[model samples]
Target: MNPLFRFICACLFTLMVLAVAAPGQAQGDGWPVSIGSPAPDFRLPTLAGQSKSLSQYRGKIVLVNFWASWCPYCRDEMPSMDRLLKSFPKGDLVILAVNVEKRIPEKYRKAPVSFDFLSDASGQVQQRYGANRLPDTFIIDRKGVIRERVTGGIEWDAARVVSYLKSL
Candidate 1:
């Protein structure tokens, strides 16, 4: 094998290893909060003008979703999320959709969803949660410990996902 080819292969292998290992070890800025970490508490204004805090939902299973209206994936997964919220009885699960965009889109303000939509216009709460990516979701258990961190869009209302959450 050529010397240059060997060097390239070694570098590629190193990069692949780092990519696989990074998320499990990532902390602080620019990374999603690791699973099992305490969900970061924040109080943000709602579209209705009232403010809500994560600590207030400590006794309930909280689904903290970081999303933007401009992201198609975010929009696609929203209905599933709404269904997920509705599947549980009131107070069983608390879904807080934190909008990271500077302006809350008009459509969302009018959408009929029981869960609260919060405004993180300054992105302080988003950064604190390390939700640098759109459509990041953290499932915080009743005791306020983060149980799962899901990046990208998913079928949140799927039976398997809902069942897993119910078991939590």
Candidate 2:
């Protein structure tokens, strides 16, 4: 092969490998709760200006979502989240939405979000969840164990998922 063609082929092959490997790359600090490890506690301020601790909600199901206002998927999932919470009898499930400050938009600045919106501005909580994607969610059982996790955005209010949520 010609020298230039060989070099170009090498570059193309390298790009291909990187492209395939990119899916495993860390999108955030890689904070998705793993099995057998305690979920890290965080004290994040709610949109209402009150602070909350995950540990404080022991014995209740928690749906923790790492999201950003700019994420179209996050935007799409918000209404369902709102509806899911409203459909519940309150205290059965709680949402801990942490806006990764770097990419979040300003429009999401309000309080008493149908559920709860927390901030991971410093990425402390983000780092804890091994969150590699936006709208990543973990369904914590009432006993505080992470039961299920969605690395990509999820339609949590789907009939099946909602039923599962209700069952939890």
Candidate 3:
């Protein structure tokens, strides 16, 4: 084997190892709150102008989603989230859709959202939750410990997701 070829192969192998390990090791960088971490609490005004806080939802499984109207994935997964919210009884689960956009879009205003639609106009709440990406979701257990952190869009009403939430 050629010396340069062997060196290239070794570099490629090392890169592959890093890529595989990145998700677990990069948790602090990409996901500020890891599984089992205590979720940060914050209070923000909902679309109805009511002040809401994470602590207020204690004893209930909460799904805190950070989103923006301009994000296509955020908009796409909203209906599924609403459906997911409906599947569970009112007191069984709480879904807080925190909009990070400064201005509320006309479509969102007109949309029939069953969950609590909170407005993070200044992005303070989103920042506290370390939601740097749009459509980030944190599933907090009844005790207020974050059980899961999902970044990006997903089918909120999917059977698997529903089962997991139910188990929590």
Give the range where candidate 1 is weakest over 10 consecutive residues by summed lDDT. 24-33
TM accuracy, model 3 = 0.78
CA RMSD per model (angstroms): 4.1, 5.2, 5.2
How should the candidates be ordered by lDDT, best one leading? 1, 3, 2
- Model 2 lDDT per residue over 4-121, tens place: 9999999999999978986665434353457445576779887667999999988888888988877789778887888788787878888888888754455676533587777778
Residue runs of model 1 more than 4 Å from their true location after superposition: 1-32
RMSD of 3: 5.2
Q: How good is model 2 by TM-score?
A: 0.75
Using TM-score as the measure, the top candidate is: 1
Q: Report every candidate's CA lDDT.
A: 0.89, 0.78, 0.87
Candidate 3 — which pairs collide? none
Candidate 1, residues 30-100: lDDT per residue as tens digits?
Answer: 46566788887789999999999999998899999999989899889989999999899989999999999
Give lDDT for model 3.
Answer: 0.87
Candidate 3 lowest-lDDT run of ten: 25-34
TM-score per candidate, chains pooled: 0.81, 0.75, 0.78
